[model samples]
Target chain A: MTCEDLDRRLSEGARAADLAAEPAVATHLARCPECARLMAWLLRGIGDVRVDSARASEIARTGLKPVRSLPPARTLIMSLAAIVAGVAGLHVVTMGADGWPLLSGSQAIVFAAFLAVTLALLAPAWLSSLRPGARQRVHPVAAVLLLAAGFPALAALLFPVRLAEGLAAEGVRCVAGGAMAAAMASGLLFLVTRRGYPLDWGRTGALLGAIGGLAAVAALQVSCPRHEAVHLALWHGLALILPVLAGFLAGRRAG
Target chain B: MASPEQDAVPPRTGAAGAREALDAELLRLMPRYQDADRAAADALVLTAGPVLARYFYSLTGDTRLVEDLVQECWLRIHRARQSYRRGEPVLPWLMAIARHTRVDQYRRWKRSSGRETGIDGLVRQPSSDPRPGIENSLQAREVVAVLHRLPDSQREVLTMMKTNDMSVEEVALATGVSQAAVKQKAFRAYQAIRKALGVSRREENER
Candidate 1:
């Protein structure tokens, strides 16, 4: 065999099996000094590479701090339940005379559908945090968030209303309430799942943020008597942005 | 020319079996270490320390730096112990963390120094001082020096394969690439090293 052909075969042979055991390569190398030199160089180079473990004992003596245990999945689920309860409690305390406007009729169905979608999205994030290597798929989180935010816009088309319903006046209160509720929920999630090694922190944070924002929106739906599409779209729909942004920031810092 | 098929023989299954057994044992010890058992932690260090040190050495070829990286890798492993699943293979998981730690350290060093330390940094200068008989061989030193000339991706794959004895699937999992990609990188790395060594040999003959 030509020198180049022998070299290529030896290299390819090394990848699949031991080069030394290849009889033809061995026979050729034994006769060819230059090929022998190359073979010797490759074998010795890999063989001579050695690691000294003199400091292994010293490093072991340094004594590592015990890793903190991840909170149980049950605790995370419970905390979520608590956040829902707190938001409901806040709604009961601050709700205006609109009492049960969104709770009745087709509005109730839409509200329930929104809550179901939000919970479904949030469930995976919470479960993933409790279990390492359980990464939530980004597509689902994005889809759910789009649906949750765009629901108001969809409603606006179905039920057109007068543009100036004084919804802008109540914007500050709605945003403030939503932010407070989101913060509470996010804080609880962050505390419980902080120890987790999320494969993607931004995704996790965004999921948690969505959960908080959706919960706040649901609470607002029950408390705020205004059924105006503009009120829900401009004020309530926009509140989710706060949590999403906060979550992205928190996730970046986490990793 | 003799085709490889004509010369190929059955691989030695005994060696493969032994390696599998060792990996299984290491996998078993990971949970104990996660549970805060100091002895388990120490044992893990002792068992995996040499392998990790060799991995770093293959990357940087700096003994002191390799030692420091090994320490840093262990520190990360300790911190992320809770993230490890009980029954999964430990080496890939550990290597994944070690890989990230090395990348982070390299970035930090680059940022601080405002300089890039690539393959050139890993190629050690021939030492004048007397060394141990076997290790002092000139051929081995020359071959290792040539390895440092490979690109980071190729060098990483070669190191994981040659030094750590990781399978393509394991490397793919650790490096977050497909198995086909790992094999391609390994083949490319081997070709690069062989071509470079051939050129160097020809240059020596002319000189």
Candidate 2:
């Protein structure tokens, strides 16, 4: 064969080697001197890799353990908390307009019953763990659905309709503050639970302090209720930011 | 410290370890399947386990992580086996999963830590240095250096050939290129290496 033809075949051999071709590409290879030399060189290049096959097998075998592959409970808790907080906030807003004064004596007792139901629904992480082998492997779909159902339920529970006349003068600030406080509490508990404890008292105290700051912001907004759309929008923006920051700080510290 | 005799003994111990691990894995896998499916999985793991590790080593750079990474990849493959077609290139499917796992590792590390860990760690192992007396290994290194000078397409083809030992037909299949096209790319791969290594025309012709 011509040099070009030989070079072409050598290239073919390289490609053939890559594909694990049948009949060894031997017939074509035997007649080709340049290809043979190239093959020798290539063979020399693919060196012996001293692999411990047994060790590899050991690792592969152990990989059958499906435990670690499961998603962390913390992620589930966070998801549920988000849903609960959003729904609870919505409920509180609606309640203020509807006039449910959650601060009153007998009304507080009724509100607490609703709150317990809401918490039962919203705290999916708790509900899921209650199921047999539930803590072991919670499917993503189930976790998501649990969050979806619980959030609105919690919101409905925390919706405080009746507020004091003074609090109304401050606008929906009390309702917003109450909703945010609940969110902060739930988020902090989730965070603490995720850290292998029921709840760390120190972390809770710290979170409470953070939530207090958020509540103060809510108090300030109520006293000077904004009239302009832009001002109300900013107030809403601050409302989301305050609890998120508190939860974030509380969660991070809990870990 | 253990004596040389004791150190040498672990390899034999390792074989027994393999068997024990196999039994344990079978216990886990068997409960998840019935009849032929269990038998098929058992045979597949016993037959393909070693080769897959070798493939993983070839695909990735860190020798230390190969064992864990390959094991994880296989677990994923086993879990997703219901989707696999029978009598297909099982190795290729497995390799694809391994590649995806490597990419995921890269992305996860990058996202979490904010830095690229380099492609070497992803595929070309660094646990063992290139063996002595392997002119091919030397050439392969030179080829890799030359490949970096080429475009990504050419480099990828070169990598598949050198690392995976895929024939031209296999390379073509993997890359969706024809056999002739694979040869053409292979020629360019060598040419780039030749040019970079400063080999003379006579020397190249002789080889």
Candidate 3:
């Protein structure tokens, strides 16, 4: 073989099997000083980069320290349970006099459908966080966009009546309450998932935020008496934006 | 062809064999380490430490930084130990943690110093003073210098492949890229190194 062809093969071999060149390549190198020199460089370069054994041992000694971590799956399940409990508790304490009219009719169906989509989108992120090599099929940005667009569309479809009387004054209270609920739920998620090193913090954060926002909306459905579409869309539907934005900022910093 | 005795490259099957043995031992010790068994943790570290140090050094050529990063990497491994699935390859998981540690450190440094420190900045020149075999050190340093010149993606793939002895699949998993992409990067890196070596050889010949 020509020197160029031999060189290419040797390089590929070296990249694949750090030390072992093919027998044919080794045989060729035996005769060629230039090729032998190149082989020497490649082998020695990789083989001779040594760590100070003493320091390595010293560092390894610290591994004796106790480290407590929960499995990612367990942590995710617990976080979900906590969120569900927290929302349920909020509903029990603050539910309106009408008492869960949204739970029985077309409203319940829409809520169930939205909940399914939310869980499906959030599952990959949670699974990825727990399992080191788990791949998230959807990109975080795309997930965020879908959540943003889907929330309003679903809300619009579920609650179509626009009351003549504007409830713009109540928007402040609704947003404030929703934001508080989301923050609490997001905090619990953050605490649980902290042990697992998420590769993409923004994605993790967005997922957590989305989960928190959904929890807040679920709780708000029972507590808020207003059934006006404009009120739900403006105040309740847009509630996820705060948590998502916050989650994005926090994920960027943490990840 | 010349006689086999004249061949410069030694048989390296022994090195690969030794590495695989260490990997097996590490896989065994990881669970014990998670359970806070001091002896097992130490054994695991002693086995995996050198490999991890080399991996970190490949990213940041600074010896001191590699030492620090190695310690940080071990701490992270310890923290994330419970999440590690049994029977999975340990090296890739460790390497993933190391990559995160390095990036976090770099980000913190950049924020604090307000200076742009890319991977190139991490490549410090190997010590100039000669110890027993200066030629070997020089060759290694030349290779490292050349590596620092490549794009970060190619350099990272090359380092994981050559320094850590990771397979294309392992590197792909650690890097969150496809196996094909890893192979492509490795090939590009090899080509770059070959071109650099060729140019240097021509320069020496001219001189």
Candidate 4:
């Protein structure tokens, strides 16, 4: 075979043994000794490379840090106690019906249906955007929603809404609004703190939407009053919490 | 005719000897410079710098650029220390990093510098006349044109084989492939080089 032809066979895995078996190649090898030597050189050459093991050891030596343990029991207990107090405050407001008529049959069912549909559409987009390195799977959106909804309702029980002439004597209105604001702030803090956590979009979104919806309901009960704690609990609470929850959830999952 | 003279000798089994020598050198270097091992490490890099610079020089036949490119490789290795997996053989990892850095540099050079440095000069012998031109420096080039032409896998396999003194089995183990597979890839790579250069593979059986 010509030089180019021999080159082709060599490139294509024509082993020396295989070439020897081929009458044409064998004949050529017998005539041209240089090609035979070159093959030996190539084969022998392949085994000469080595990685110095010590470098690996050196790299290992430099990188790892000790993982820290969690906080002490005293700190943990105090934190938990504070959280419980806040939650209790919110629950008290929601139990008070005051002058507002509690939704009995059809209205409750309609609200539930509306919530389910909104969640279905928003859930997938929120979940998919979770970052690769995130450790937690709890979606911030859901937490914020749940807080906004639950806080104001509880606050209403403790501080009932009252339609006053001006900002003064709007005791119930102020209390419920403060609770909703606090809940929303906590939810945002939770999300930011666990920035690397993977969000559970459906759960988070549903929780936020529920809170916002409940707030809307409470606001309607208070009427178009200038200073009703019930209205603040419902309208302002839902309005503030839902959109923030929705925005954060959307940004994370819409990737 | 010249091919027959070079083909007369068979491949000697010097790998055992070479590996022993390498281990001895490392062992000697480690104890003597234990306190200054980090310094020694820097020294090793400085020493090996030229080997690659020269190799690239041979491949590209660009005397002017080879030293600068080699320096770039060192900088990259220093910068990329965090990502590198520890407890692996240092030479292979270093070489791998060096290879990648060179490839990146080559890519950047090609884009910005245009096609001033062609792959064709890699195998060509440097001119004896040597008035200091790209063509004059070709003789000093390492003739890795065949390697350059091979697919990346083949090139990598060949590199591991040539530089690391790794057997096909070791290469397979290190790269997480089968020995037979490495052999097959290596063979294909060798074949590509031969075919491209229009060279006969007659002496391939000499070993």
Candidate 5:
């Protein structure tokens, strides 16, 4: 047996060794001080760690019944991405594509592409909030926050900044419609991930709100005719931001 | 920490070692537990007890905290049981929950106490010379005489490996990092252990 075998046996406690009977074990022991050091402790009979069975009961108690596991990450994430697409697309179709005719062909393509990439990038992080050990390329909160900031900046570069009459009033109408879509998206996202075991409620809640906000912004991009930068920046930005704050509060409460 | 269920997992034969057999058994128990099998759950707890306790003790070095963490870990594990997939290695799922438990507790303690406790008192261990050789005790702080020389990540990998005879895939999953990361950390840890052991052997040869 190798030194690792000896280590395993030592880890096994009692029935661990027969130094005189196994020359390989003895010779390796003679050479490796770390194993020998642990062996010395074993010889003193203080090596075994004995914990109470009451502790085991705590574990068994939790597993006492039938339950289904969550679906694969790909399934969950794809469905979330689908939620963004379905909800935004449905809203835009019903509301009319007035903004499409107004935008330069290039302007429309890049804006639509940005929204598509944002949703795609976010799908993986969406899975992270559902499982404690899931891999995260970027934190969900940070990702959502970046979209909140980045989208407004992108709109400023892509759209006109001309001050329009009744900008506040028109902005409110646009934000109201966007906020409704965000709330709907948030509700659906929550429903999809309802079974998830979020290690942090606030972060999960924020993601929930962010998804709603994203659906609204995407919906407005096509349905709302006005392409003015300030309207998009002021109203569309709030549409996503408020829900995230609300989601964080709700998540903490649920936690 | 040994339990009756320790005998309950299907016994290994041929090339399978005890740890491999145990891991296989754990993999089987997880799906059963999801299906609500009390026996499987009991077996999982009994078999995993020593490993979880060792994982915590190796990290915190406090027996009391280990007990609390184990208990808390179970509650979270039960609530999060459904989050585990049907066929994934089970230890990673379990260790991830155990880690969450530790971090949650640490946060609560920090919030309530308003003072930072260094991750453990291990960092506070006295270093006055006498340079004890490798035969020193295997208590949490003195495992290798140079374990403290390891950064926490490397030390954590070594302890987890020792805890369950965990393979790289299991450790990588448990720590939620890439397998390459686990290898690098374990490599660094073994280097430290060997250096400490080599020094002791050189002294013995000189004598």
Candidate 6:
């Protein structure tokens, strides 16, 4: 057997003696000193090197002091949701919720449905960032990309406006408006979650940025006058990308 | 890779029962510790000291730094106690913090590599067992030496599993990665060890 095969077998729990009993493995072991050493170690087993912890308990007790635990995950989750809602409410209040009224009843319903689903999806990510050792099945960047694309995709598919003169000219302003809203919401989240030590800072930052971006998109959908499909889709997509990019960079920097 | 504890065949009494008892005790003490109970905090440090030491020892294999690292970890745990929710398994939280401490120590060491004494670089820890026997034929240093060549994250995953007798799920929880990621790192680490050992052996031969 090759040296790699021997290692694989040993790692798989095959006894060294049993492997050595085979002629090919023995021959291979005869030439490969590394394999031979590995076989010898496996045959004899290893000794435990003593670790000194005599003063650890004493050191630990001396350092003990007062500490207040964080609130429940639900409370933190609500606080995050509140940040988004608060930002959206303020945007709608200040800018006016005029765009949604421009759409048909079914179109408005579809838009609201998309926003609701996006919020539901994002809540767990916020909760996971707060809790240490939280299991994230999907990588953060992938999740961010999918969620970021979702808003614009909904806009592209549902709302197709005719190309009028200066149709997409106002898109940049809308994107900026959404970005500001995102930045504000994400900033509030950072303040509230300052005490939280996210194991994956990048994930936390990306999700934080995405939450803010989505809030801006939702708020702008209602408040912004332009309901043109390309305008909404392009600006909404840019809005989503901007905050996620900021958060990602921030997360990477923090991490 | 098979855990070192599993490979060693050492006579560890009530390993599972001991683990369960420790788990229960730590869980019981965590909430109290968070409530500013000095007595509970002391109890926690004392209880988790050995386990944390073993974990750090396995990851870094520097007995000298293990104590310091453990203490630093406890300080972090105390500071981040606010993040630890009630009724959660406390070891994962403690272990998760311990990992960051180890990582931070590594980063600091890397940053100051020009000034490092290089003492911690030596993973060749002397065995406590002095008796002349089969155990003497294979040193723990050699096993750790083979492990030392792995990438940091892979090495941490493998050594923590093998030496600490931690399961994949537990390691995943401690490291804040998926269990699949843990398994993949372990499998890759195992495959890499053979190649690493071969290279190390060649270097020694040339010397």
Best by DockQ: 6
TM-score of 1: 0.67
Q: Model 3 Cα RMSD, Å?
A: 6.9
lDDT of 2 by residue, B1-207 (tens): 988887784432332354345445544453343222444455556655554454444454444555566666665555544333333344444444555556556656677877666654344423445444212244444434444554445555565565555556656544434667778887786666545444433556789
TM-score of chain B of 4: 0.55
lDDT against the true structure, per candidate, is 0.66, 0.45, 0.69, 0.44, 0.72, 0.72
Task: Give the local distance difference test score of model 5.
Answer: 0.72
**Which candidate do you rate higher for DockQ, 1 or 6?**
6
Supply the global lDDT for candidate 4.
0.44
How far off is residue B63 in model 4, in Å? 3.9
TM-score of each: 0.67, 0.37, 0.77, 0.37, 0.75, 0.74
B207, model 6: CA deviation in Å? Answer: 12
Candidate 2 chain B lowest-lDDT run of ten: B81-90
**A1-255 in candidate 6: lDDT tens per residue?**
786677555444344556788998989989987778666644542343333334544554555665556677678878988899999999888878878678888878988887777777677667667767665545555557667777777787788765645655677777778888999999999887676777667778888898898899889988877777778777777888889889988987887
Best by TM-score: 3
Candidate 3 on B1-207: residue-level lDDT in tens?
988788776645554666577678978987777777877876877788777766766666666676678777776776677767666778777877877788778777778878886755655665443433212355556667667767888888888777776777777778766776777777676667767667778888999
> After best superposition, candidate 1 residue A147: deviation in angstroms?
7.7
Residue A207 lDDT, candidate 5, scale 0-100: 83
Q: Which of 1 and 3 is the better model by TM-score?
A: 3
What order do candidates take by lDDT, descending? 6, 5, 3, 1, 2, 4
Off by over 4 Å in 4: A1-34, A40-255, B1-15, B23-38, B54-61, B81-87, B113-153, B169-182, B196-207
Alpha carbon lDDT at A244, candidate 6:
86
**Residue A140 C-alpha lDDT in model 5:** 79
Minimum summed lDDT over a 10-residue window in model 3 chain A is located at: A11-20
> Per-residue lDDT for A1-255 in model 5, tens only?
666566444333213234524777778878876667655533332133435646667566753677778987778877888888888988887888888778899887887787777766667667877876666666676678678888989989998798888888878888888888888888899988877787778888888888888888888888888788988888888887888898889998887
Candidate 5 collision pairs: A65-B36, A66-B35, A66-B36, A182-A212
Residue A148 in candidate 5 has what lDDT?
Answer: 85
Please give the C-alpha DockQ score of model 1: 0.24
Model 2 CAPRI rating: incorrect
Residue runs of model 5 more than 4 Å from their true location after superposition: A1-48, A93-97, A137-142, B1-16, B121-141, B144-154, B178-207
